[model samples]
Structures are given as structure tokens and as C-alpha cells.
Target: MAVTRIAAAAAHFGRDLDHDLGRIGKLISDARAEGAALLVLPDAAIGGYLADLRHPDPEALPPALKPDDPIFEHIGALAGDMVVCVGFCEAEGNDRYNAAVCLTGAGVLGRHRKVHLPAAEGIVYRAGDSFAAFDTPVGRIGMLIDYDKTFPESARTLALDGAQVVACLSAWPASITNAAPKMSQDRQSRLFDLYDCARAAENQIVVVSSNQTGAAGGMRFLGQAKVVGPAGNVLARTWAKAGLAVAELDVAGEIAAARRVLRHLDELRPESYRVSR
Candidate 1:
């Protein structure tokens, strides 16, 4: 296949849609400067995430927009030739969903509504039912939003559907109960990187993990954006700061190299393992 430069962002977004759009434009410009073909922005890139996870105020929730919102068109226009995966809150009648969409200059390639929800998310957003991968100029790509990447099956399903790269978008915060004085020592910080590496290693696919940094209401987000190789190696990273983690990779070539001896997907024993609901 072809070598592609991919970027994962670590930036903060808030309630102001106009401000968020401007921040996104800057990130897009930065990625283009790095010659990135694919760029993955954090969850809630458009409207921001809930202020308090345990007690989300419905009155102050992120602005919900339709799937075909003109905002997306603006993103597509800005994306031009580069493929971009960004997170937003989707509005459908009375129901709302935490979702991600993949797009380029032409139009949208695919979209994924977050399926797995942490306790507080359900109070505001409806859960999605399935995981699917779609073809893009970059490759067959899949997306996961925030808590979705916590489940091993989530990324596995995307891999089974033939995704070469999985973009994990998050507005994940530091531990609510056990806050660490240092960002490096934070519990959620470790788990975030662990999940990214594990998902890529297990699936033998590239993982572009992007997260929001800085504080939002009572929550303090950890920005450990990175690009993980199929062997679970962190190719590039921006740890505990706001920046872009860019890496040039030959997706098909790397996957092939990693799976040559131990093909994890092909060697799966689905029948022997007990399936969970």
C-alpha cells in the first residue's frame, strides 16, 4: 500500500461552537503542515463534553446538531484533500447521540455513534448499537468515541470488519474519585494509553488516539494523544499537553509484517471461547 502521514490531536474545546470551530481550523492547518493524510480530532470537538460526569446538567448539555449540519460542511471544506475524523453530538428528534464522522474535501465517508456509555453519558446521549468500518482515501478506517475504547470488543469488531486504522476520540477526564496531583501519575492517564496500545496490538492495526486537554467544568482532561503501531508500540506521542502526535506509516505494510508469524485475528478461537452479552 501507500505510506500515509496521520495525526492525532490533543486540544481543548468548550461550549462556544464558533471558538471550537476556530480551534479545529488551527489543528487542521497544523496537520496539513506535517503533510498528514488523515487527522483524528478529540471527542466533542464541535460542542465539548459534559461538565460533570456523575451529575450532568441536561440544561447545559452540548449543543446537538443534525448529522448533515452545515458545520460538517465547513469541516469538509477545510479538510479539502485530507481525511478527518471528528467527534460531535448528534441531534435526532428528541434523542441525542455522541458521535464521530469521517470526511474529506468531497464529503463524508462514514460515521459512528458511540455505543458504550459510562454511567453519566446515558443520561444525556442515546447509545449506538453497532460498529462498522468504511473505506476512505486513507484506508478502511473505523472510529471509537471516548468510553467506547474501554471495551476490547469495540475495536475488535471494527478489526473484524476490516479496518486498517482505528481512531479513538476521547474527551476523557482524570479520575473523579482518586485525583493524582501529577498528570503523569493519574490513574485514567495510564488506562488511556494502555487501551490504545492493547487495541492496536490485539487487532494488529494502527491506532490513532486523540484526546482533549485542559479542564472543562469540574473535569480535567488528560492530553496523551498518540499513534500506536500494530505491535503496540507508540510511534509518536504528545504526552500531557496540547499538540499533535504525527506519524508516517505504511498501514498495509506494517500490518502484514506484524501478522506474518502470529496472525491474531486469523487464529481466533471464537467457538472455544465463551461469548459474553
Candidate 2:
């Protein structure tokens, strides 16, 4: 099926969940106008990446800092013909999770909890250990939240599950600047770019990344959202802005090219690649 990937980098979440939902609604409306089939929003697009909004001290947050506060219903309502995937803070009893929720034409089809939490993430959020992919109307989709994108194993799991596109929702720091003095910043960007591109090229699938933008709390978010084609070519990209990137992926072409080029799927080296506990 033909699809368009929409990436939106916008303002931080507010206490008014309805307002945030409305803003996202507008984004989806815009994407739909452009004929987009999938909307991939940044991490914590609903309530702001809670870790960034939270104080270093866990005690600083309120008792009901998180729970089903109507955002879910609003987001659920937004799902219809298009598939929407967003990162948000998930509240489960006394604990919270850095999670990504997938809303397809059917409804909330799947959720993948973040397995690889960054250094300070463990301070306020609980890490999740599951790696899974869900079937979507267009194709099978996989999700990875922020830090989990750094590892290839996560993408491999999704590819193994027959996912044609792996979507990443992230809230990364802007320390990776493009300034002359901050050459390392460019390096950081390239690192992630190469990682995502390699995942698509090697697996013969597509990779769509949507990251946050602007400053929230004391942290500056880096927005470098893009889509990599099966051939590792950048199909669409946004240069640190609140915008959308649409790209059409060729699932059949990817499968055919993968078999013609690498043919690794037929090269059974699983015994050698397997790790011992």
C-alpha cells in the first residue's frame, strides 16, 4: 500500500491535555490534507517527556502527576483512517513507564515500553524490557522510544517480526550542535543517522524517526526527524523544525532488492551470531 510519513516537532506539552491533543489534532489534519498515511510524533508528545519536565528529585512531582487524564481518549479519537504513533508517559499504579503507543485505523493496536533508558532516565521513569511489533493497516510497524534507538538489536527484533518500517519517537538533547566549536555535535548526528540508515539498508526495510524540538524545562531538544528508504537513501528530512516529512516506501521493492543484493536472509548464520548467557 502507498503511505506517507508525517513528522511533527512542536511545542512542549501543557497541563491542559485537551489543548495538547487539539494541537496534535491540527497536525494530523494537516498531514491528512497532504495525504499522509502515518503520523509519527515526538517522544512524550502528549505530556512532555516527563523526565525532562520532572525535577532531579523525584519528590518534586505531585501525587497524581500521571494517570489516565483524558489524553488517551483524545488521542484514541484522533485515530481513524491514518495510523498515529506517539511517545508518552505511561502510569501504571505507583510506577511510570517511558512508552510509545500505536494508534492505527483499528484503535490502539500496540505499545512498546522503552527498554534502554538513558543515564538520568532511571531517576524518574521505570524501564521496560519488551521488544515487539504490531500489524498496521498499511503494513507491520515497530516502535522504539528514544534511547532504545541506539541499539541494533531492537530494530533486528522488529525486522524479524516482519515489520516493514520501524518508527522511533525521541526527545534527544541538542548538545549535538552544528556550531564550528561543537564538531562533536555533527558527529552525534551522524552517528544516529548512520545507525538508522544501516538498520534500514541491512534489514531491507524503512526507518522513520520523529524527535522533539525547542527547549522544555532546562533541556534543549534536538529535532532531526527523517525517513530512510530501504536502500539507505534519505527519502525525506526535517532540519530541526516543527514540520512534517512525507515519503512513500516500496515494500515489494525492498523485499525484492534485499533478496537480490545481500541475500543475508538466506544465509543462515544464526548459530554464529547467537550470544551465550
Candidate 3:
């Protein structure tokens, strides 16, 4: 297995599409300079995310773009050889979905519309239906947006579908109801890292996670971008600031080593598991 260098970004972005693109371009260039094979940007990095996720105004939503929009082409142009994963608000006729796409200089490799909606997000965006992994230059990859990573089934489905790396782009905020004294101390901050580590360890795959930082609208984001190993180790991480978390790993070797003794995926008994509701 080849060692792949990957990066996850934690940066603040807002409603301006052109400005966001410029920021994305600069970040891509920087990642390329560092020889990163994959770069994952925060959710809604294309046009920005909602200011107040808990009670977002229906009429005042972030600008939504079509999947085949020219902006993605612009992003693709900046990608060069590195695989880039970014989130955006997807517009499909009258419905808008929280979505993320993986692309390279060639074109889009795969797309994922967020299947899980948190709090008032359900009021503004339509939920997606499924999870699937796709081929990329670096490895088999999958995507999840924001609240989607909160569920084990989401990442599990991707891993089961042959995803070696899962890029989770999130516009996740600090505690909405109970504001913490420090960003690091926030409840959601802990949950964010916990989920990232748990998902990677449980499935024995690499996890690239990114989130928004600073405040957009009234919501303050926890900018803890990170790359986690299959052994549940945080290979690289960024604090509550706009920055990049970069790591180099032998993806296939790491997964093989982690699963050598305890093959969690192979040992699962799906037929016996049941959900009451």
C-alpha cells in the first residue's frame, strides 16, 4: 500500500460564493504544495452554511447550487491532482439538500446528500436516502455531512461498501443550548472527536474530518479538523482555529494491521440485530 498524505481544513466561510471559491482555491494550492493526495474542506465551504442552524429562516437560506453547476468546475480546476471533498447546499427544483461532493481535476468522483438532519435543519433541507462509497485516485472514498457522522450506521455503511477513507465535512457548531466557557470544553466539541475516533476504530478505516470555525450568524463553530487512524489514534488535529490538519498514512496497511486480530466488520451479526422503531 502507498502512503497517502491527506489534509482536513477548519476555516470560516460565509454567504459570498466568489469569496468562498477564492479561499478554497488558496487552500487547495497550499495542500498541493504540501503534497497532499486528498484535501477535505468544511461543510458548506462552497457558499457558506446557515447562520442559525437551530432556527434558520426559510427565506434567508444559504445560496444553493446544482450538482453540475460551473462552480464545481471551478473547484475542479483548482484541484489539480489532489482529490477534494467539499460541502454545499444543493438546489434541486424546489427542494434543497445538505450535500457534499468528492472531485478531482478530472471531474466529480462521487456525491452524498446528508441523510441525517439535526434540530431545525430538518425544517430547511430535505434529507438524503442512502450511503455509498466511490473510487478515487487515492483510494475508495465516501462522504458524510454534519449531523450524518453522529450516527454509526452512516459511516458503517460506507465502510461496508469498501470505503477506505471517509471524509466528513461539517458546519457543526458549538453547543447551541448550553454555551461552554471555552470552545474546547463544549459538549459538541467532545462528541465531534469521540465520533470521529469511534467510527474509524470500529470500521478500521481512515477518517478525514473538517468543520467551520468562527461565527456565522449567531452560531459559533468548533473548528477541530482532524485525521484519525484505523487504530483510533488522532494522527493530526487542529484546535479551535482556522488551520489544516495533515497526516501521511499507508491506508491499506493500516486497515490490515487494525483488523488483523479483531475484524469488527467481518464479525458483525446483522441478522440478529433489530430496531424496534
Candidate 4:
């Protein structure tokens, strides 16, 4: 039940791998300076997300990296004693997937390819098949990529797999078609926050979320990175800016307290849930 400091970053990343790595290094250093044991960087931190969500140019897509790329070692070296989670476009043969990976100085601890694809996302990346939780230095953790968190079943599957903390790495953007003048008035802004808080509260698991800032082509990202407690209360947030949302908590203790009154996971009636194959 030791208290752990967590940091979620909201920053802009582009197609330049070198520039993105430098920015990521700065974020890792900043989080480490704040005594953060766990840091979650935004989705597409390695390269970047699609320039246009609906009509992404196939030639202008983010550069996909292999799982065993030397840059991962570089990131791990920078992580040192901290547990870091990051996202990137993954290349597997001729196929590519929007993916995330967890690592430390030791190497990769776990990895997840996005399971949910929104609109034209399937046009560029292949969808993953499952959700899984894995052990890390901090604790048992699971990961969700962007649109994956929009569904309750995504987080629920991870929780059922014994995840204590969920790192939701997103490159989520503001409304594409229904754009709003004010960032706060944007529909995606509300839905982003709603999903983060709702998923954490419903699963009673700590959620460390991060998103991209600034615009990539026609898309303007929403950067409401945050750390949400198991009770759904946002412990800290970067709001609509590019920065780190940092918070400290005893992960196991908070989860224990939240579930003590009514254990949501344990009380599930699987027989009653109807689903399509």
C-alpha cells in the first residue's frame, strides 16, 4: 500500500521521430523531477497520430516502428528507475497497428495494440483482438489506445484480468465535422473527460490518461490529460493545455477503500449480459 506518484502528459508530437523523442525525454525528466514513479506519455508519442481522422492520406501517416527497435532501449535508458508507458504506430510485416508499450530500464514489460477503430481509422491501421493486464515494477497494469477507452467492455476486460491501474494513451482530437469555436464547447472534449472518469469509476481502478495537443493537419487535438482515482474524482489534470497532470496515491489502498462498500467487479452477473458474436 505504498503511495505512488503518477504523471500523465499532454503534448504535441509530429511526424519527426527525433523531435518527438526529444520532447518525450523532456517529459520523462520533468515527471522524474516531480518524483513520479509512473509516467504515461500521450498516444503517438513516438511518431504522431493521423493528420486527418476522416480522410487521412496514406502517404502522410505516422512512421511505424518495430517492437524491437533500438529507440525503445533509448527510451528505457531514459526511464531509468521509473515505469513509463508510451504509444506509437506499429509495423508488423505489411500491416500496421496503433499500439502502446510499457517499459522501464529493464526493457518492455507489456504491450497492447488498439482494439477499437473509429471511422476511417481502419483504413490506415489494423485492429487488435484482445485486452490484457501485465505485471510491472509499479503494479499490475493494462493499456488502452485512443478509441479503445470509448467502450466499457475494453476497460472491463482489463479489470477482469487483474489490472490495478489502466494507462489510457490517446491522440484524441476535437470534433472534426462539428467543430466548436471554444475548446470547452467541443463535443469531443466532453466525451473524452466523460470516458476517462466513467471508465475509472466503473472499474474502480486508477486511470492515468494522456492526449495530444496542437493541430496535425486539419485535426486539432484535445489535451485534457489527467489522473483519475478509483472513485472517479480527477486528482489532477492539465485541462486544455500541454503539460503534465501529476498525482500521488496508494494504488492498492485507494482501490481497497473504493471497493469495500460495493465491489463492482465481484458483483458482476455475467449470465445477464447479452452480447453478439
TM per candidate comes to: 0.98, 0.86, 0.98, 0.98
Where model 2 places Cα greater than 4 Å from the true spot, the runs are 1-16, 50-55, 59-69, 176-184, 274-277
- Per-model clash counts, in order, read 0, 0, 0, 0
Write candidate 1's Cα lDDT for 142-178 as tens digits: 9999999999999999999999999999999999989
Ranked by TM-score, the better of candidates 1 and 2 is 1
- Tens-place lDDT per residue, model 2, 85-177, is 877778788887888788854567778889998766787778898788888876889998887878888888888888888898887765422
- Count of backbone collisions within predicted model 1: 0
Worst 10 contiguous positions by lDDT, candidate 1: 116-125
lDDT of 3 by residue, 101-160 (tens): 999989999999999988888898999999999999999999999888999999999999
Give the 10-residue window scoring lowest on summed lDDT in candidate 3. 51-60
How well is each residue in 99-200 modelled by candidate 4, as lDDT tens digits? 999999999999999999998999999999999999998999999999999999999999999999999999999998899999989999999999999999
Give the distance in Å from residue 171's predicted Cα in candidate 1 to where it truly belongs: 0.3
Ten contiguous residues minimizing lDDT sum, candidate 4: 47-56
